[model samples]
Target: MPEPATEEGNRILSLWQGSWLAALIVGVLVWGLLIWAIVAYRRKEGDGMPEQTRYNVPLEILYTVAPLLMILALFYFTQRDQTILTKVDDSSSHSVNVVGWRWSWAFNYEEEGVYDVGTPGEPPVLWLPVDEKVTFELTSPDVIHSFWIPAFLMKMDVVPGRNNKFAVTPNTEGVFMGKCAELCGVDHSRMLFDVKVVTRAEFDAHIADLKERGQIGKLDSGRSEVAGVS
Candidate 1:
């Protein structure tokens, strides 16, 4: 599979792959030890109740402490990566407000005042500038949904009353697929969208195009107010 297109996504993917490699190494060692014990200790007809041994303090402690250390190491790496990914700075060059509805998505470019609305059949396209930090403020006017972009390897829940935000710098320029990862209602499966990461010039042109089409304005009524937290 293609690696993530964003820097944060790549960092997260690296952590995940590293964790998997560690698990594989541990699994192989443990399985080899188990199999060796099973074969080496197999009962022969003459070997009746071979030496009843109870406590090997060193071996017991080794097994217990080794796993605990491994778990702590993994936890440390995971937490570090999460902090790096979730820490949003005020240096983002662009901002997009995402609203998740019952069946589709709405994206409002806060700076340009351009908005894109998705429908059941026709999905919306989110335009972003490549290699630039973009902040996404996710909200849900109706039910709970999730804004997920697979290429970015990031997904955040769109709750009704909370203003969840995340930032990503798309390093690659291309059109990527996105969708609502959560099942909100009947049309949840069809809640799809496209993400276009282009150059700064192209991004500006896109906003101008939207302005020409009269898609430039604030979001619809009742969307600005945050609903009760659920």
Candidate 2:
């Protein structure tokens, strides 16, 4: 699989892979101890009753405190990563308004006053500059949808009534695949797009191209806000 394209994505991936490794190590140790105890304490046919012992306070405390500490560690890391991923930096270099429709997407460059609308077969391309943070405010006109970029390892819901926003700084320069991870409608499977990360000059040129093609206008879906929280 392709590695994550953004710093935030890389951070998340590292955390995820690290957690999995920790879990595997713990699982192996615990299982190994279980098997050892089963074999070592096995009773022979002529063996008498094993020595009866009441509560081992130290062992009980170890099991309790050890699991508590592990859980606290996991919680801390998860919360930290989530905060880093969802942090919205208003000072981003570029801002795009993402609208998820029935089976397509609309990328509106709010600052540039240009928008790119996608169709079923012909998906739109979102352009961004490498090493620059881009802010995306996502919403939906009808039902719920998701904006998922596989290479970025980022996905957020596009709800009809609210705006969900996130920021990503592309560290790699290349084209990556993007799609709607949520099942919104009949044509949900066809909702796809491309993310092109390039140099600042190339990004500017692409915007100019969009402008030349007369794709320079604000998007108006005419749908009323539903007051639902994102």
Candidate 3:
């Protein structure tokens, strides 16, 4: 059966293909040359064995140099792809703080001045502008947990004492589901949230609407209600 491919799996596949093809070529050439050398140098069953020239420095060098160059080329491209794909360009990117509580995710858009404090019915949904970079500063309020959004192809561990930083840019605009990939405790299964990627205008509208609805912050009337009671 053919193996399935994923976006990340594809990147890995390409990296392996480079080294495998080079090795395959060398293997076939080495085998063919060995056959030819064995046939040409072999002595008849009854004939005395010819004296052997044990080692050729040039031949040994050729074998060593070929594989070494292939390996170096493989490492070079692998690292290049890693840096290009994962490096964060913060200057042009927006920043969000993703905090993992006991069993919830709160995606705070620090740049937008909105922080959805993760209520029960309304969890913090990360709204990102498609094709734009966004930096995530991840931390956990208690215990260890993991933050993963598979569709965007990034994940990192959230430690209580440390803040993890990474970046991603969604290529397609859509709602991608993410969950606490770690087993934090009994309620870990319910730690779910969605990442919404929209256009810049739509994102602005969403924050405005969320703010108005008292989802991101206390709505104007709700605030006035509290003031009236106090």
Model 3 lDDT-worst window of ten? 217-226
| Candidate 2 TM-score, C-alpha based | 0.89
lDDT of all predictions, in order shown?
Answer: 0.87, 0.87, 0.70
Predict model 3's lDDT versus the native: 0.70
Error of 3 at 180 (Å): 1.4
Off-target runs (Cα >4 Å) in candidate 2 are 49-55, 220-230
Every candidate's CA RMSD: 3.5, 4.2, 7.9
Q: Per-residue CA lDDT of candidate 1, range 1-230, in tens?
A: 35899988878888889999999999999999999999998998888778879899999999999999999999999999889898888999989999888777888999998887877788889999999999999987788899999999999999998899999999999999999898898889988999999999999999999899987775632223223223
> What TM-score against the true fold does each predicted structure earn?
0.91, 0.89, 0.61
Better of 2 and 3 by lDDT: 2
Name the better of 1 and 3 by lDDT: 1
Query: After superposing candidate 3, which stretches have Cα over 4 Å from the reference?
Result: 1-80, 119-123, 214-230
Check candidate 2 and list the clashing pairs. Answer: none
